[model samples]
Every structure is written in structure tokens, then in C-alpha cells.
Target chain A: MTGSILEIRDLRVAFTGAAKPVRAVDGVDLALVPGEVVALLGESGSGKSVTLRSILRLHPENKTRIEGSIVAAGIDVMALSGAALADFRGKTVSMIFQEPMLALDPVYTLGAQITEAIRKHESGVSADAARKRALGLFERVRIPSPERRLDSYPHELSGGMRQRAMIALALACNPKVLLADEPTTALDATVQVQILLLLRELQRELDLAMIFVTHDIGVGVEVADRIAVMYAGRIVEIGAVRDVIRAPRHPYTIGLLSTRAQGGRLSGKRLPTITGSPPDLASLPPGCAFAPRCSSATSACLEAAPAAVELGHGHAVRCIHTAAVA
Target chain B: MIFYASKRILFTLPIMLGVTIVCFALVHLAPGDPLVSVLPPDASQVIKEQMMALYGFDRPYHEQFLRWLWRALQGDIGTSIRTGRPVSTEISKAVGNTLMLAALATAIGFLLGTLFGFVAGYFRDTWVDKAASALSVFGVSVPHYWLGMVLVIIFAATLGWLPPTGAGPGGSEDWKWNWVHVQYLILPAVTMSVIPMGIIARTVRALVAEILSQEFVVGLRAKGLSELGVFGHVVKNAAPTALAVMGIQLGYLLGGSILIETVFAWPGTGLLLNDAIFQRDLPLLQGTILVLAMFFVVLNLVVDVMQTILDPRIQRA
Candidate 1:
């Protein structure tokens, strides 16, 4: 409460099944100060989304084994249950998903769904007040014909409008920590930029701590104050956005930056993709999970995973030969 | 919405016309002269010819069909060849009993099926789910008529707790929405409901399971709704599919009620139809079948409308 609005320490989430447990999120540690937006950049299987979902304890409890702690807004999120857990979800931490159409229930009016959420968390709030709040949210999100749009179903809205509505719903309870899992990934390029700008503006205005999960470094550069690059269920690099983008130390982060279309050394040539596929979490090698795919891998790198070493200006990189690569 | 309803109604006419034509043709093509069935076996050929002439059966099939269709359009289905009574009057008397029996069975089936299905789907992979699934499978595989007979044997014959057949003691007068009449309705209605209940439970379970897996469901949970609230939303989303399934089951129940009514000698349309078929009464047979077909078409239209009302996505479509 005094330092970071959200703090996750040594969080490990493994999905146990008939075969072997897959460590989707392995010993992640993150902290978000007030008004800070951290973009978690990673490929599809890099465990970024899993790490975000773990904060709310969204994974199936029976199959997923979660260890360590998640504390948001002075409450122990991992220890909460029943009514306490429900209260922590939207009141303390809310999430927005990538596919807006799939995220909103198709049957109810957007107003009804939003108001229901409001009323569920605030028992004393009347339905009329909740509806008024929903209307205000619709206007805040810049939806056209806000009053009429409230009565419209999710399918009636365009893709961008639906995503805006989803954001509006997430902010209805005014949680301190907002977890956006690739919120703009499903939008058109122009719309994606607009949504990112809107999110950044809202985050600044409301002073909300947020985690923006995306695989695009371009998006990270555009929206994040800091960037955390994930590879095979571990944070490979973390630093200020400009610092990480300007001089990426980890091999995976370097590979990601080189593939970007803008201002990279290989911009006009064939895009520089990482040489090997990501490691399988279920049967990862004993050393660094990215070692097999790392072009700068050495005998020492193969023998053991490297610890995160701090560079100047709060930049950190997890690699044995970071100085040599730089 | 009104346009959709009108469009559906307009579409139903052609289907009803086709059904009438098919019903008329099938009865006529059936092997057996109505006169031979109506007249005494030892009667002279002269009497048979006279009877055929009286009923206008001597005319060509098309002319007879046209005549029947014309009378039918005037709200008169003509007289039964065997009973010499108006087909409309006979059907009107039988319809009330059939409707009551079918409605009760449907209500019972839908309520029980939905409850079992919700429990099964919500607690999937547990013993409660397994028991519900086993019961549904058993219900689905067991023949309705056989189930009806077994129920009658156990509840009526062996226990001697209720009447075994025939609506009640006073027949039409006995079925006046009273407890005395309800006892008579139990055996047959329960028999008719078994298959429909099983079908509905299976459909509801599958649909509920599917809905629970949808991404919006997770969003609803993330909204901080209690478990009950989440379930309420799930049922609302799944209602369209459930209603559509129930509509089909209603049609099946109506059809099945005939056999059930006959089994219990309940004096409903099924019993009347069976007697007509046995006696080779062409007019009565055609009338009963056409009415049942119309009921089916109308029921489907209502179901479609209900689904549209329940789901805005369908309305837009």
C-alpha cells in the first residue's frame, strides 16, 4: 500500500495433468507503482498472459497449482476466498481481454451488464444510479449516441466500440490495478493505436497502475512506461521502455527488437526472426530456457540459467554474456 | 418483429396445404373401401353401391379431394363415415383432453429435465452428474409405451392405487380439472413424459456445458458476480437453445400423446385416430392428421418467435 499498488513475488503457476506439469509462469516477480503502465512483451507461449491472470487467481483451481504471493491494494489476493475474493476482483483489480466480442455477454444489453457489475460490488447503489453511472462511462469512452448505445447488445457495436465498452466495464468499479491482456491485439492497426492512446490517457488521468500485455514491441514502445520481455515463462529483460528498446541486452529481447518494422537495422531486409522455436515448458532444458534459441549461447549459458544482473538506470538483463553481447 | 411473425405465418400455409394433400392422398390410397368397412359383410352389392354414392366415394379422387378441401376451408371437415357425426365436433371433444395431458407432461418434463441438467452441467465429472446422466440415458432408451405399461402395472395393477385406463369414471365429464381427474392423468402423462424429459435433460446439459465454456462466461465471473449470479447469466444466455429444444419436444409430446392416450383408453385424439384407422374412416383420419400437422407448424412458429425474443442476436439475424 505504501510503495507499490500491486506487488507479485516469486509467483509460480504450474498446470498439473496426467502427463507432466507445465510451468506456465515460473517464479515471476513484478511490482507496479501508482500510475505506472508496464507492458509485458512476449510471444504466444511466453507466459505473459498467465502471469497477468495469476494476479486475479483466474486459472482453474483444481488443475493449477499456484505458489507465492499476490498483494494488490493492501489485500492478500492469493489468500482471499468467496465474498472476499469476489470483492478483490473488480474492486481491487479488473481485467480487460483481447477479444471484446467474446468478452461481452451476447444476450444482455451493454447497460444491463455494466450496471449489474456496479450493483454487485456496491450493494447500496440503486439500479437507476448504476445505470446513470453506466451512461457516464459510455460517454467517457466516447461511444456515439451513448444513451441509445446503452440499450444495444454487444453484437450491435463495432469492434472498436465493443473494446471501448469492455474497458468502460473494467473501469466501472474503479480498481487500482488494471490488467489488460493484449487488449488491442484484435483491433485494426488504426483502431489499435487509438485504443492504446485512449488507455494511456485514461491511465494517466485516473492514476491507475496497469499491466499491458502484448507481443508487439511497437505497442510496448507506444503505451508502456517500462517493458518486461518474457521468454519461455521467465522475464528475460526488464527496463524503462526507451532504455530496453534502445539497447536490448538479452538475446531474445534483441531478436524481438530486430523483427520490428520501424527503425531497426534489418528494416528493409528480410525480418530477423529468432533462429529457433521457443522451449516447451513441460520439458525445458536444465540451463536458461532460452539457451537453445539464443544465438549467443555458450557452454556456461548451457550449464546453468543466468541470474538477473542490474544495469544502470534500473535496467536488468538475465543472460551470462550480456556484456559480450552488448 | 411483426414482419417476421407474419412471414412465418405466411410460410406455414403452404406447408399446411401440402400436409393436407398428403394426408388426403394417403388415406385414399390405403387398401380398403370405406363402404365395405361401413356396411355389413353380408350386405348386397346394391347396398354397397348406394352407400358409396351417398358418401360421394364413387367420384374420381381429385373431385373428392377438391370437395373435401372446399368443405374444409368453410370450417367444416364433413361427417365421419363410420359415426355419421361431424368430424369437427368429434375432434373438438377429443382435443381438450389431449391438450391437458400434453401440457401437464411437458411442464413436468421441462422442469425436471432442466433441474437435473443444471445440476449435472454445473457439477460435471462428479457423482451427481453421473447419476443424472445415467437416468437420462435410461429414460432415452426406454420406449414410452412400454414405460407407460410398466407404470400402469406397478402403480395401478399391482398396487391398485388408481384407475388403469379410460381418462376417469365419467369420461369427458370426469376430466374437469379436478383432483379426481388428475389421478387418472398420472399414469399416461408420466408415460408420455419419459422420453421428452430425457431428451430435454441431455440437450440442456450439453448446451449448459457449452455455454459455461464460452469466453463471455469467464468475463462474467471476472465481473465479480457471485456463483449464483454467474449461473443466472448462463441460464439467460442458454435459454434460446433450451426453448428451441423444448419446442421440438413439445411437438414430439403432442404426437406421443396419441399413443399414450390410446394405451390408457383416455378418449383423446389418439384414441379417436386409432379407432378411425381400425374402422377405415377416411374423413376422420384425414381430419385428425391435418389438425396434428397444423399444430406442429404453429408450435414451431411460436418457438421461433420465443427464441427471437430471448436472443437479440437472433432478432437481428
Candidate 2:
């Protein structure tokens, strides 16, 4: 914990609405140790993305209020204002957006954009030096013909190439923490594997602490050291990736596992899916957020929300029936 | 690229020729002959026929057109019916005056418009941008003649800073070294610049705003580029479209300066054409219209070439 590059304590974010505020991120506590890869796994609208964006204060102002202590690289996120925040964003932490095509500027060549990144963090860096570093980054990301690719615009390259360039851009500053918001989601299966492998290789090479947000549990299993399962704006389960995948504690986590497990084998028949849609943020069920979807929900589960249960060995679950289920 | 340009020019030539032919026919179609208007009501039949023959007006319309076209191709626009002066010589003097005035006005307009437009785009939602927008609207709305009269009232009539009428009392007589004539030319040029300046500023502002919102600008900002740094790059990248707009605006400015020229009596094409109409000078009037049309076509071609040059994507397209 002391070697943690980022720590979010009781982070809460809510959107302003007419009738009631929609709680996007509710009482989420997480941390990423240096060189550790923590996967924030969940379906859409599960607050995984909101938590990621809140770390960088990337959410549009005036529409949402964030309440939390986000400590990244020894700097308090909530306290850092304007220029300090921007400095922190470009130096201590860099992010790769979901859409690689939209991540890089189309007008400029890849090298120019990457050089700009290098220049942003390091003062008085010469343009020639920045370009050299950018070309080196392109090579590091395994982009073939790096020099030519450097001179090419984003549109000129393929989707996988653009994503690699984006990763190069993110790593150019050599930030301690790298936040990838579903970086491989838009790519094809082959490209996704390539990007994922490239990310793991780069992460190992750089010893970078990564926060990978993804909806695919399989992807999370592939790269994450630990997995945090999110449901209805809260972490329902957190543990080592192997332990979480082998034996899920929370009912929602179990539901996710079953849904994904059913898709493991390729068959002519359609795979079984979760029975119901995720809860709407605006009108979450009272007491337990996932109660309505849990078959094991008891009167007590409906009357009171379960507290975080420390199940030993860094595994925690927010469920009243964990012991009974096990 | 040269082949493409040549093909476009060739395609445009016949259309232009057709327009000129239509214009020539329309002038003759108007009520009352140039002969009747130019000559006295009680002229002798002998003198009337002789004047008609002298001007080649006695020939059939088709024959007269062929002769005029032949002369025009030979660079001889024929003598003015009213002034008995060569059309080319008369128009050339007026053209020199107009060139000085129009060139000055256009330069001032482009500089002011581009500068203000860049500023407005930089401080997008600020009061300065709003003020620039308001000024642009005012420039577009106000008539050139009214603007001219206003300038005359403020600078000429009240302050006695410049003369009220004519390019200068010196006229063509001492245009060679007349500093007073140059001083007198300033107001009319400034008045003529208003519409183009306003239009160019408005267009530049919109273009800059659009370019600023592009992903490239956002990427630049994320790289920790200062506002000025981001702005400079964005403007440079967006220059092709912005310059294209400026070129079209320049063409419009040339076409529109006629009213301003006439009001100030700047001895430009507008004034020469007006004089020809009053004197019923058919040759001078026809030649001036043709020249104006040619100027417009040539200017459009120049802008087209410039647009292709500035952006290679356009050239490829």
C-alpha cells in the first residue's frame, strides 16, 4: 500500500438530475501499487468508467460533483487545481482513450503528436530530441516501418496501428500510472489480442502501474493481477484474478462468471445470458443495489445493504450471504 | 495539374464568351438607339447617314458584332462615339486610377479582416469576439454610399482633413507626382473596404472556430500546449479554407467597389462606364463591361489555383 502509485478512498460522484441525482460512482475505494495491473471490470453504466475518468478529473465540470480523496504520485487529486491538475495529468499519469481513432489528432502526423507529448512533460526538450524519442516509442510499440509511420497521419494507419501509436503517445511521458479505458474494445479480435499483448509487454518493460477498465472478464483475466467486479456503482467483489474467476463471492459476480463461462465453447446454439438488464443509476433499488436480481436475496438483504466482508488474502465481497453460499 | 487547369480554363472560356454575347445583344435591345441618343433631334439626313457609316452603325448587327470582335481581338476597342477617343486609351487611364485605389483597399481589408478574425477566434466567447461580430454585421448592413457620405461628413466636411469630391482637383493632369491626389484617394478606398473586411472577418471567425473544435486542437491542448501555441498551429492548418474564403471575398470586393468609385468620382471603371452611359458612348460602355467580366473570371481562376496550391488534398481531389 505504501508503494501504491494511486489510491482512491471513498470516491463518490453523482450527476445532477431534475428529480434526483444519479449516483455514478458510489463509495468506491481502490488503489494501484507501482508495477501492479488492476482491472476494473463491469458492464456498461457500472461506474467503472466513471471511476477511471474521475481519477483524472476528466468529467465535464458543472454536470457532476465528485467527492473523494484521489492520491496519485503523492499528489491529492481533489486538492490540485487547474494548472497543477493539468501538469499532473500530463506528467504523473497518462490515459489511452477507448476509441483510438478519436484518441489521436487526425491533422498532425503521429510523430508530431508524440513529440508534443514528450515536450509537454519535459521542459526545454528540443524538437529534434522529441522526434527521436517519438520514433523510438513507435518502434517500442512494435509499429513496423516506424519512421514512415511517424510521418503518417492517424487516418493513414489501420485501427491497430492507431491504437499502438496512442499507446506510444501515452507512454512517451513515462508516467508512473497508465489508465487505459477499454483500449482494445474497438479493435477486431486479432488486433485486440495484439494490443493486449503489446500492453502487457510494455507494462512489464516499463514496470507501469495500469488501471485497465473492461467489460470482458476474459480480457481482465488475461492481463489483470487482480480484478474488481463493479455492479450498480459499487465494487461487489475484489480479489486476485485467478481466485475471483475460479470462485466468485457476490451474486452479481457469479452472474457475470456464468454468463462469460457459457460463452467459452463455440456451439451452434446461442449462449445463456444474464436474465435482466443492469439497474438504472437514477432509481437504484433500496437497501441492496443488486437485491432485485439476486435469487438468494433474503428479507435482511432487502432491508439493509451489506458491508464489505474481508474474506482473507485480499479477497473482499459486499454480500451478506457469502459465508452461506460458500 | 497544368493539364487540369488548362481543361478548366478551356471549359470556362466558351461560357464566358456566351455571356459576353448575351450582354452585347441586351445593350442593343434596350429602347432608343445610341445614334438617336447621341445626335441632335434636327440633324440633316445626310449627316445622320454619314455619322452612322463613320461609326459603322449603318452595318447589320451581325456584321457590326464581327467587326467589333475582330477589332477587340486585335486589341483595338474602337473610338468612343461621344468623345471621339480610342476606347483602350480612355479605359487604360481610368484603369490605372482604379488599380491604385482597389489594390490599397483590398490590402487594407485583408489585413484588418484576417487580424481581427484570428483574434475573435482566439477569445471565442469573450466580449472582444462579440464586438468584432457586431462590427462585421454593421459593415455588412451599411450601404457603401452611406458609409462614403458618413466619412465625407466626418473627415472632409467637418474636419476639412480631405477634399469632399473627385479623386483630386488635380485629376489626370498632374497624377504623376500629386501627393494630394493620393491623400484624396484614401477615403474612397477605406469606404470601399468595409464590406469585404467585414465579410472576410466573419468567414475567418467561423472557420477558426470550427478548426479549434477539431480533435487535433484537443490533442494539442492535452499535450500541454499553451492557448497561443494551439491557436497558431490550428490557424496554420486551417489556412487553406480561410484563404479560399478571402479570395472569393476579394473578387466580390472588386465587383462591389463600383458604387464607391462613382460616389468619390475616383476615375475608375465605374466612373468611366457612368460617363459613357451619359454620353451615349456605345463602344466605351461595351468595352468596359467586357473588361469587368474578364477581371472577375481571371480572379476566380487565380483563387482556384491558390486553393489547390495551399492544400495538396484538394489538388489530389
Question: DockQ for all models, in order?
Answer: 0.80, 0.30
Write the residue-wise lDDT of candidate 1 on A1-326 in tens digits: 25998988888989996499998888788888999999999999899999998888888788899998988978998898888888788778999999989989999999999999999999899999999999999999899899999999999998999999999999999989899999999999999988999999999999999999998888888898999999888888999998898898998888887776666655568866778788889987878998887777888887877788899877999898989999
Per-residue CA lDDT of model 2 for B1-317, tens digit only, reads 79767776887788677757865786788777778867889999998999889888889999988888888878898888777789998888877777777777877777888777887887788899999988888888999898999999999999999887786776654575467677888899899778778887888888888877665555555545655667667766667776776667666555436678777877788788788878778888888777677777877787777766655445545
lDDT, candidate 1, B137-193, per-residue tens: 888898777888888899899999988997777977645667777889888888777
Residue A16 error, candidate 1, Å = 1.8
Report the lDDT tens digits of candidate 2 across residue range A162-262. Answer: 99999999888888999889999999999999999999999998999999999998899999999999998999899999889888889888888877545
Chain A of candidate 2 scores what in TM-score?
0.96
Judge the docking of candidate 1 as incorrect, acceptable, medium or high: high
Q: Candidates' TM-scores?
A: 0.96, 0.81
The native-contact fraction of candidate 2 is 0.32
